[model samples]
Target chain A: MAASTIMKKTGAALVAPVGWLAALIDPPLRALQKATGLNGMAAFFLAPNMAIFGIFVLFPLVINFAYSMTGGSALFLSGRTYVGAEQYERLLTCENYLDKRSCVEDLFWNAAGNTALFVLFQVALMTVVAMITALILNRELRARGFWRAVFFFPVLLSPVVVGLIWRWILQRQGLLNYLLHQFGIDQVLWLTDRFWAFAAAIMVSVWAHMGFYALILLAGLQAIPKDLYEAAEMDGTRPARVFWRITLPLLMPNLIVVIVLALIRAVQIFDEVYVLTGGGPGTSTMFLTQYIYEIGFAQLIRNPGLAAAASILMGAVLVVLTLLQLAASRRNQNAGAAK
Target chain B: MGRITLDHIAKAYGSVEVLNDINLKIDDGELVVFVGPSGCGKSTLLRLIAGLDQPTAGDIRIDGAIVNRVPAADRGLAMVFQSYALYPHMTVRRNMAFGLENSHMPRKEIEARITEAARMLEIEAYLDRRPGQLSGGQRQRVAIGRAIVRNPTAFLLDEPLSNLDAELRVTMRAELASLHARLKTTMIYVTHDQVEAMTLADRIVVLRGGRIEQVDTPLNLFNKPENLFVAGFIGAPNMNFFPGQVEETLPDGLSVSFLDGQKTPVKAATNSGAAMGAVTLGVRPQHLHLAQDGEPQIPVQVRLVEALGAETVVHATASGGERVLAVLPGQPAIAKGDRIALSYRRDLLHAFDGDGMRLAGN
Candidate 1:
């Protein structure tokens, strides 16, 4: 830890000379800006940041779409032949959409089905739990800072680290079984059993991400004016009644944000689940992200076409979610405008 | 039924005390306004009365029952906050219904109460609209309507009209006064606006530094402020003070003059044993005007003249840089840098003793 911290300091120190060089050029840049109008100068200064964003983010996005349309597994688009909608057809044409076994690429359907279930369970349970935690943290409770840090601590951990920590406690000879044995109960296979493994994955995902959403909701809670609660109290509003009538409705906007973000995160979950159960005891714990990874890299036959198509499908799902988020925020804005 | 008595109520947050020995008896069906500068604990006092906050040491009684330990919801009071605090998501209709719903009132009676309140507020047309859709004044009325549906024993309004614009504030003030007259329910209002206090309250409690400076009718507070702070606070175009020390004691009255050796008061009276020493004499701006040839006057050079339509305010400095304001009737054709002589009317003078307390005999 100390060596890493020293390295970070060195890294920052190494950038100072470059910063000085930029400062030297700043005067000439300002001189040029003075000769030009504001829009020209603004675009001139924005060039570097925009170039970086375009290269890193937008360029890859376009390339991913390009890859989805190509047939063979060529790294470069020039070496690959165009398949038009062939890969998309294989994905969309399922004999029985409900049952993945009858689909042309059955594993993709299975992963997609499992992910839908995961998202529904995870988002519902996580939101309720996070909101409750936020409400409690927002109050003047004892050890408030400590409790807040405790809840948000998991979010700071690497996903692999979080998975490793939970894995030790849930394994067959893990701490959980030992505790159950001490309580005079039989040891249950937590990760080996299909139902339990799926449940465990959902539980771990919720535990890891709940704090982040709770922190957001906490901010929303604190932003509410204190006088409202005082007024509600004077109106003879019962505590539970106040929560239902005032707190819940006023917090709906933030809750929408939490749901959208949590849904997106759940759709992309890979690292923690992969480390925890390796997409098994069967395909029960496999997620759509893992399915994409398996096809793109892990399979004996590397089918980049199929993997890219699956990812494109996932991207479409994300777009719909983002649109839902946009609709929700617009509604929230209308509510705010009324206020 | 809504008589409230705060018995030696004192509040302390940790080691810092905000209110000290506050003893007040608010009568049933009366409107009392607590007026003070910011951070004078007026809102804290209101919250204590509403049972929203507990006093560190004392008891609060409503209708002669000790209610210090009773929860806020059991206090049978409604408060209209400065922010209005209306539930934003609920319709105006539902916002008014929330409190009644908590009480398990029959739905028909709740509807009737809501309808009557909405009609009274002239907000019946907007009942279906959420608070976010209403204008500021409209939202304030809905806040009041929500309070009215409960029909609680009393109402606590903490600067309810302060959020409105100037024109709306004046009308809302009249509306609130008429609301009090119609309901005749006991109310305790808190505001820093002395004008709001003077106009809306039957009696005004002037507070300074966590203690009551004086409490009286509006005219009494205006005409006879009890101290330097109240005198300065209770008037617009605020009262001018001339710091003077007692130079002579006569059988009829004592004589005092401005600290700058330019003028002496026509008459200064001291009630029997009241000590005569360093004193500050206060006169409202309206009492000072263009001097007659023979009358006593303080010479001042004008710094600025504000001709505010019906009246003119001459902001000038007396001898030795003492600032004074003279409000003259109608338009006074005075220019900046014009030297002026101002007369002091003996009857309109107020005197504060060395320690800032009002001298009883004036």
Candidate 2:
């Protein structure tokens, strides 16, 4: 009892300075609150974050839009001429829209076609694979934690590291071909063939980031109550029917999130694929972001104007896709409520 | 055809056992309730019968066939979960029609059953609404309707009314009893509340620590509990137990003595083997009253008195430091800290041995 009393005294002594410090600042804070009502105080506290966002994000976005409308290869605004929509017109000019070779900006058209195909295949594959992985991991298995860690470990690896590791494994004299040679098979130019290289890019991208998407899907799957499944079981629902009717409908929201995020990320594919293929096999694997980088910085006599216009066009597509998805999700919600 | 039987049912997770040697039988159209405190394996036993779980060892027969290896769906038993478990995304109509659809019933038949069930439960107005849009009671009705549409041989309800508010629970309890009477399907219900068990059950199985204490009609379990646990668990405010010793075995009954050396002849049906030994005398509060002139009495100091308008319940301490409660009829003048003498008829007292088993009596 005496020791507890002494401890209590010590605790009070330790808290004394914090109380004094609060007293010192309390009046000024009260005055500030009085000067600015609640909403104004909220804005006051948000000012620093807003300033940082304005400088880093909004400012660059505005400059990029300005660059898209201008002419010349100058990096600074003062040196460029306002040529107003010429870049966009140049991008849109095409003899036969289906054939990239017929477009004036054939490289841009080629990259756009490649990105469209990549996003279609990559997003579908990523969502399906992640959902399957999440379902398997959610089951009651031995060393479940260890298996989950093994699946999620790749998500922690740097994209560059992922690219390098796959490159080593898929190169001509790499582990895959070496092992094939040990079985008396001829070596294949895995990264040089156009179809194989494109396939490799999609496969590697899925492998590199699927764990994160799977983790999101796993959280969704877990949020579904266990008793619902039991109820379905008692209802004598066939396994496939239950998946199609119950699991799929309940999992729709998370599936939409995964698809949209994967779609956006697939369009912005640069670093890993760039490291792996260098947009090679004669530009077969080139995508929109890589095309922008090449025009903005990589090529001799770089054209920042064209690159900025292409990026803004890509951003427009993304915004439209996001709005469409948001509307779709909203319709689903309203339908659910009405039902 | 829902007569069900469990022979030597036992369940354990790894080595830690939850139930042991549970045997029970239910008639074709009777409503049996499993009532016990939590962790007494009531829910586990229900799940075993439902085929949601495989027992560690047992033979479960539905009708006359051993269904130990049958799947839950094949067992033809529909369960109403405590959570109500209606698919949140499905409308009430679809929720009820899901099982019928799975059975490949014709579309017209499915709609007919759903309409009938919705009309029966008075949930027709909400059939187009999803579970999320309905109130708690409505959701519960939808859950029951889902079970009813299946036309299963037996209905397994696991604490189905436990999630409702008190007033709603009482109302729903009456509805369930009436529904059972109308349908006449064998039903096995699980709950920890003895009142629900007593009100709804054709027979109540009282359990403790996963072992069956007594299985009898509601009033029988109340009037003649086989063990001390059942007696204490089955009633409101609990039966009051006072320590005593058996003085002698009379031809009529056993003579028991309290700490004050006052002899009370209890008219119980016991053999001559009820010789001199320690005993616990249990008397329900309702059986006790203020002592009349020149009768055997227990002197107590009233610690508290709850004078509910219908009855007066006095909580007091006996002279021997044992807590005693007496429920007297109607409003009577009583106050806290008042000295009072209570009395009871000898036949109303229950005696138990040291092992917590009720001494043989009617």
Candidate 3:
């Protein structure tokens, strides 16, 4: 067959099933809509989407919870022995919550502590950097597109690749060390020291995600009407005053989103840091996911139950953070909607 | 102290020029309105005066001091935006105080000014509420209050009443007129609505295609537009145009022939150079009357009749497929497809030269 004929045949074949499905599915929907005198058409439209969400999201959530409840080496829930709250108790067994050395699962608690520190530093630093970068980029700058692409490029990289790339740059004989050497400085251990490795991990994590948050913040900045700024300018408002009184307040909702997302992703971080630091330099930079990985699949006998419990706790933390953000966002929206 | 002068001001964005060689002087305590259709650079001209946008090639002076290099913040001018542009998060009190605070005014004085302006605008009840909490009219008042509190040399308003409902707009328009009268600050208002311009302006500057078409008082603009654009733009029901050429330059006036073969000897005072050329004769809808037996007659085919209570605006067609609108007093006995004869005085007719500039004399 000629190319055009083949294309026509392919297009027809692709469209035929969709047409058949529509023909078969539409009548009952219309009938139901008329019979019910309610929003039956909306329900009909939503059914397929809901089913996909349920099968993927809801199904996995249930399985994960089930796994957390069972004390199991087995993958299947039916094959595992049920131990209600036992795994959770084991994970939470600590003389003092803040003291990771006192915990029964010392590595898990250590990872938990490190994750907290990582989140605090990451969220705060990322927000400030992203905000400043967004503001600078939002201006009529030279090579704006190129600068935006440069910032966003790291976000497009896989976490493992990001770790690998940073690992190369932060090694003792890396590009950073070479630059330092050019300044006649001694070679300092970057990844092999406890403090430097942890700091490097945090810095690398921030660099990788700064672009994403900046993009979000940039959108929020752009959404502000130019006339408000003009009005402020005409009102004889200083630049700083305009930002504090208008730009920052209006950007609160988008900022809250960046903060919450950065916190959640910081808690769940494993891949890049694992590849970069190996949760090493004496487990200084190990996080919750790394702890879970070590428990379930790596160094020790597979403790899937404990790992699942730890992960569930992590999920709960994220949920709480999200709820707080949602509340803050709702309040800001209410205030914003009044205007 | 608010006398603003634009000296050969021009603005362009790369190759696209928006305002060109604009020169105008706004006297102190005068409310000059820049009225035109959208994209006529009215707002751009206002921005230039306010020092929000720099003119690409000229000087802007306020109070006889050159302020071309001055930033908008230091220009000491206040502008009320079309959007109100209230700080969405700040209460009305803080919003009005923000500019004063930036100027480092004493807190007591700021409070006093805010209180006085709020009372003046009758918006003291809404001081604690954000702009979002107020109704549209109330928000508009707050916006005006913000400007009033500044007590600057000049006030630039960019269609401040364009957002309100029609009835509210009328009320706000009255308030604005009274406010301008009381304050007597040099105000330059920009609007696309000619009615707002006519009703509010001491002088209306009509602009088209990045150039000022005419500048005159409301009465003068209505009675004598300097060009065809102004004539058509200034009135509600646009002036009727009959395309014709000057047939003779008589000692008294001029003789013109309409395209549809109707010849009328214009009995105006004296003809100028612009009188002898291809011309367009403009008669406002209100000026045309139902012809009596002896007067000059215009044969028209009535197409539409709109009975607007006290008056009926009849949409009709004249010879050569030209559209004619006649706003006659009272509900006339007019209907669709009615052939009628109309008459207009030669003195009421506006004759434009080939270049669209209004010819000298009546």
Candidate 4:
């Protein structure tokens, strides 16, 4: 009995340090050690993601706000001035600015309206087309993989490349005009006209982005259970009615996701319009992004202060829209759970 | 009301045939159950009847009119699925009214039917609730309610109670039976559980590997099984069989020798030559009794005794080394390794041929 007791004591003594080591090495709590340790191993593990996010997102955001208060080039020692919201006042009310001819009343408000129009039309069109395509491709048709690939191939192409190709096709002597000429029709100016240029930008934006929305919507459609459809059939529900009652209601969550994503991407449209129209045709298609770029870089004398103010305002609007979307999504999930 | 007939029905996927030459007649207002083990084509047959699938060769007729080409929505039949399949997004009232609304029924009539169905299912309080808000049993009741509101000519239930708990299944079974009595609509129910088939079916169709093994009333099938498969499948604990051959013949009976070489006379109708061949003797465990001594007694060494309160089961080996079970009433004072004699009533004995067909009785 004495030997057994000694052995038990020795086992406990051996296990104590090992348990301590295990607790130190545990995944969840090891983070605390990294935070408190002098060696900084935890920071080393977290560096890559943090560095990328800081450089691409956080750094620019901070610099934009700081630059909004200084009047000079973003380059260091380029003659700075502490403007104190003066840049925003100038952009909002200045009448003699060289780019002010592009504005109807106020440059900022006109660009905002143009961006809203572009966002509304493109997002609505892309969502409808994407949902319809996803529904059709999700059926049990022959060569389904081939059809999905055909519909989704556009998303793989670079937006710049897509814009350039469509630019060539929409020009006066391009493929569209050539086709029209085959019918002995007069050439229609697609880019020079203000309405036509706006229409062209919206069309190119949808064409280049519809595939991404379609892929997401297709996944959501496939996630719906097939048994529900069979149950609808057994209830003597017609095909159209089943779609409206069962399919549409169940797909609302996915539809909201598609709408929000498309809206976000649509409002930020730059590359395609830049390559195709260059925000021309008397500023009809000049969006907020182009307007900011012209103020910051395109003009001979870069106005970093004004560009920074515009960027901050656009960021604020985007944040508000995103927060509203998140709140709506949360409410929808809660309602679904409550049922 | 409609009478459904399946004539020489066969189903195949490419080269693999799943159901072959199936023929059945479901009379109007009768509840027929298609029961089998898993992957036995029971669900496929139900789908065929509901027009969810078309048979490869045979024709399906409803009320003497061929409906092989009719789509599911035009078949005028309702189905209750095993998963309930109530629309998760719609309230109970909306789910029941959806079909009527699709058919362009007046809004007032749709509301009335929905109210009636909700009242019938005792879910009036839940008309505004979605299926996700209800329990499994309540969801199933809502599914049934959805079907009732359609007022179809027939109802197809595909293992609709398999999702319920055991106690709820029993209660739902009674509820479904009463519902059938009230509606008197032709119902085709499918299940893998024989208890459900025996209790709920007016007639049970036993299927095995895409073929119909037997179709008969539950009691008749229990008492007179056609073959070894039916006999082995229909009973609980299963009927026990011992290998044997005819040894001699008396004026009134034939003496059969057990594998242990003991001969006992059984009243059998087979001639001596016919009975002299290879045979098997079957007796239910409940038929055997512990005897002190008898002319037909066989000595068995008890290996295990299970004393269930109402009955006792003795697992033992005969002197000839054949395993046997004897079920008796009350507890028997038998222990492991104890020797006992077991006997059965002569008329309770069953004889089968080597192929597992029942032999004629005298």
Query: Top DockQ: which candidate number?
Result: 3
* Candidate number of the best lDDT: 2
Model 4, position A326: C-alpha lDDT score: 95
C-alpha lDDT of all candidate models, in order: 0.88, 0.90, 0.89, 0.84
Model 2 regions more than 4 Å off:
A1-34, A324-339, B268-274, B360-362
lDDT of each residue in B1-362, candidate 4, tens digit only: 86899999999879988898899999999999999889889999999999888899999999989999998888889999988888888888888887787789999999888888888778899999988899888988999999998888999999999999999999999999999999899999999988999999999988888888888988776766666676667756567778888776667667777757867667666463466677777777887887755447878899999989889888999867888888988987888899998887767776767777776331
- Candidate 4 CAPRI assessment class: medium
Off by over 4 Å in 1: A1-86, A92-95, A178-186, B259-272
- How large is the interface RMSD of each prediction? 1.6, 2.2, 1.3, 1.7
What's the ranking of the predictions by lDDT, best on top? Answer: 2, 3, 1, 4
Residue pairs in clash, model 1? A338-B132, A338-B133, A339-B132
TM-score ranking, best first? 2, 3, 1, 4
Better of 2 and 3 by DockQ: 3
> What proportion of the true contacts does each candidate reproduce?
0.82, 0.78, 0.89, 0.76
Q: Which CAPRI level is candidate 1? A: medium
Error of 4 at A285 (Å): 2.9
True lDDT of residue B215, candidate 1? 88
Going through the candidates in the order shown, the clash numbers are: 3, 1, 2, 1
Show where candidate 3 strays beyond 4 Å: A1-84, A96-98, B267-271
TM-score of each: 0.90, 0.94, 0.93, 0.84
Candidate 4 backbone collisions, by pair? B269-B362
